[model samples]
Target: MLAELINPYYLQVASFILINIILGVSIYITLSTGQLSLANAGFMGIGAYTSALLTLNFDLPIIGGILAGTLLAGVFGILIGIPTLRLQGVYLAIVTLGFGEVIRVIFVNWESMTKGAVGLSGIPHMGRELLNTLKEFGFDPKILGLQNNQFVFLAIFLILLGVTISIITFFRRQNRSRVGRAFAAIKLDEKAAESMGINITYYKVLAFAQGALVAGFAGALFAHVLAYISPADFAYHRAVEILIFAVFGGSEVIWGPVFGALFLTVMPEVLRFISEYRYMIYGLIIIIMMAVRPQGLIDVNILNWLKLKTSKRRQKHGTSSQKSM
Candidate 1:
């Protein structure tokens, strides 16, 4: 696993997995609050555009660009959440879906700023400078036979790992906190949650804002890594893609989407042999899986099993250490 972390090819795939995990978690935030929001991709577009423009025009540092993007998108999330979160079920999904389309159209028609469908290019890669810094500090790349890109990949991987861990820890804490309990109540039953003194509106809006923050940060990182983006990139189709990441991954559990995104992101590549029928095969597989197990691949049972396995392993290791002593 350590050896593969520095492999450039695998690193690229890993980057996709990380980004998708972030996106999945973003939606999971809303779903946790019993809100069905499909506007994540729209918020992501806002972040990508904001960060890309800041870096391109104002000469802002990549981190500054990302921060600005995240803040701006959170504001947008609050704005959108105010009206849309009031709706429920398919209606809410439709309105949010429309919002995504509206954002995409604005990006397309606002040619003066977005360059329309021509797409932004020449965006800087976020970790390139870190690699240069490592070299300047007397680190010998030749010692490991690693190229500059590999170093860049390692930097990105570590940064993303930190981000993922921090976010996951924060979310897990939320799951145990008062807010998380309120979210659970609302999700299980809104009227009942309201009766119990939970402010449904406030919590729903907070969920939207939280989700947007994550999506925006992911988008900023995405723009920097890919070095290009366009209006079409944030279309309704993109919104649906992100939704698939959440739903197919088992939105019930925090880690489910990560698993789903990782598998789905790599599955197509693995099925590339039958290029023409790859998507057909993929769709068929999803249909079969949904039919057999609609709750998704990850659920309470699997999570518990994993936890139990880890605990046993730890106990065994502790016993060995004590005996050796």
Candidate 2:
């Protein structure tokens, strides 16, 4: 009766929210360097297919597959970044977009490996695998009342979310370090950054590679969590959605993308009552947000103002208590 009262689908949605948060952070890392590359979806596809195949064929552990996928994507990022990172603005976007399409096409045509457009199924579930592994080590989940697969999955995702956030927090702090300043300088002005002894090419490529690595990690998790994948999963619009998460949330701070991902992922579900018009409303919200708060839903200025307001409120409350005394 207790289990029936709770919605299993909500847990699934929560898992997706966590996945999207990782995706949002991935693109923000690239955007931080001012490169408008759109190849994250491609990197994601590479990670998904690579990890899926490795696990399916070789019985590789989930962690092994994820690491393999991430490293492979990073290598591709470096290769693609070397030539394409030189371009700025829309030109880079166009190239990366093309790269994404090319990857989809490859996935579609590689029937022997990817099974063509039919997609791959029966990919190992991370939760199930972990559970089995634990059982092998004589550990029982029932001891903690986590015998349910859904709860196990949620637990794993929460751990991954926590770890990913910690890494992003570390990266955020790096913004004040020398490398962070170099990234900032390059974003501000490539020529000026180059003149300041900053290696524009190296830092730009580094940012791009890091973004790909992160996206690949997210993709690996996405594949296992859902246990199926297709070329369509990494389509052009998917890349656009990831970009919107960063833009709408305000990429100036790492938390901006995280907030953006959470809001956008949940908004549709919350508006399910108006399913037909939900998309229209969604479009309008984006248009309005772009028009009104071009800096995003969060930024340095907003954070500072929020801190000021909070401090002032605390001071006012203290003064009132003192007056009463």
Candidate 3:
């Protein structure tokens, strides 16, 4: 069993884990800020299609292609977020779902750029091309300008994942900042906060844009890692799966999505021949989990809830003691 996992195919699974981890965390962004975004699939599609087309047509490097994709996706996010994030609960969910569908239709119709339903073909391979990625590292061109693709791909993934983790951690800390307070205020009580002069729209939009950026980046990474991406890869179902894992993990925290993504991505592969029954078992597990722990299977929310309850109980006891005295 261990030997099979050590094989080359395992590399693909590892990459899959990385991709889902990004997706999960990206969804975590809006979720933490109290927004439920279903448009992650659209953002992912935007990044995948953008990066793939850029590399294939312009012969650009991975970094440049990814940057271009991220920029475009962010712009689209700003446009959608400006108007949509204000809606909360099922209303916001429906709006985001519509947004995802719109992107899907565009991908299907934009044959010149996306190749429509037939899907883009003959896209450049990530192998030797991936090796050329060292140019971004300021590595000595004289020695290892062209490392093996396998080695380079893994290195780049690690570097990118590290950078991503750092960014998320930084953002999590900012939750204590004024801006974070604004988001928390809005999330907790929009009407009260708005009455007090907080511009709920701006904070919601920021959360939306941040989530889109991460999803786009995830799409770009998956594209370059696999060297092939299609509309099928970013379908609405995929977006739902990302959101499900985010909630099932713990959107209240940052790394929950990462853990959720890793767990869910590997679960199916382990089922092997029972793959046909995989999602069934997976669904049952999620249902059972939610029944027991609706907050999340691995939620840290319990501590906060217990603290609140204990403090209230102590206050009540103190009041009774004072009255008796």
Candidate 4:
């Protein structure tokens, strides 16, 4: 384990965790509004394939490709949301799942561009220009003593970390707004929320669109990090994994899904020694956790515990200050 920590592969896994966290958070966005969207993987595939093709064919900047992909995904997300968001529960999930399969089939059949399951290769490095720009500013990235890929992963991880923090902060603030209340009300009972004049469909679509934006951005990052992508990489199984992260992480908490992603991404690697048994073990652990804490690993009880601890510390500090005065 210590050796692995020192190796570059560890950094690669860390980057993977960051990417998964972003995907999990994307699902959480829609989950917050009581919508179950399984088409996140489709949006991700759209972003990856679109960005890769743009950069590969048009010689566009990698960042531009990523931005364009995200925009296109958001547009498509709204379109899909409009028609599908009307369905609720398992029916909605099935429709989104079908959409994901449709995307996979398209990628598999489009041999000329998508390479027909051969996947795209020789993807340009996203940080090539950025590294050159840094050199122009008299900064030597090589001085960091890391391989180019390692350095790129670390840089991407930091950038994504900032993005994650910003998203969490935004949602935390949103939770206090009227829109947040509407989401909560709708989640509790759509009929009651509609009685109060809240536009349920609008909020649902908005949440779904927001989720697509994040998932698309994450997909772009995944493509650049890997420099290779395949249709199967973003298939139904991958979508299910992202959903598991959201459910297991306590979607009600902004950071819960992030931690869930981190843990799940790392757990398999940690259990590498067990090989085949590891999966069974992992399944057992998840089953036990679900039975013990169905609310999730980081549910409201943990949040309330932390809040109480904070209040106690604040009270103690205030008492000390009063005594000193």
Among all windows of 10 consecutive residues in model 1, the one with the lowest summed lDDT is 316-325
lDDT of 3: 0.77
Compared with the true structure, model 2 gives a TM-score of: 0.92
* Candidate 2 collision pairs: none
Off by over 4 Å in 3: 1-7, 125-127, 132-153, 273-275, 302-325
Q: Which of the two, 2 or 3, has more TM-score?
A: 2
Encode model 1's per-residue lDDT on 1-325: one tens digit a residue.
4444477877787887888888889998998887888999999999999999999999898899999999999999999999988799989999998988898899999999999999999887877866666779998666676677777887788788889878888998898899999999999999999999999999999999999999888888889888999988888887888888877878888888788888888888789999999999999978887887788888889889997787789788885333321
lDDT of 4 by residue, 1-325 (tens): 3332345577678778888988988998888888899999999999898899999999998889999888888888999999999899999999999998998999999998899888999887655556666779987756766655555556666776777678777777887888888888888899999999999999999888988988888888788878999999989998999998987887887677887898899999999999999998888877887898787788778989987787789788885332321
Candidate 3 per-residue lDDT, tens place, 1-325, comes to: 3332333455567667877888887787787667888999999989888988998999887679888888888888999999886578889999998898889888888888888887776665554464455456765333533224445455555665675677667777877678778877877888898998988777788878888998898888777777767778778898899988887777766657777888888888877678689889988878887788777655567546766687789788885333321
- Candidate achieving higher lDDT, 1 or 4: 1
lDDT, candidates in the order shown: 0.87, 0.87, 0.77, 0.84
For model 3, what is the alpha-carbon lDDT of residue 78? 93
What 10-residue stretch in candidate 4 is worst by lDDT? Answer: 1-10
Worst 10 residues of 2 by lDDT: 316-325
Off by over 4 Å in 4: 1-7, 127-129, 136-138, 142-150, 310-325
Name the top lDDT candidate. Answer: 2
* Residue 95 C-alpha lDDT in model 3: 94
RMSD score of candidate 3 (Å): 8.2
How many residue pairs collide in each prediction?
Answer: 0, 0, 0, 0
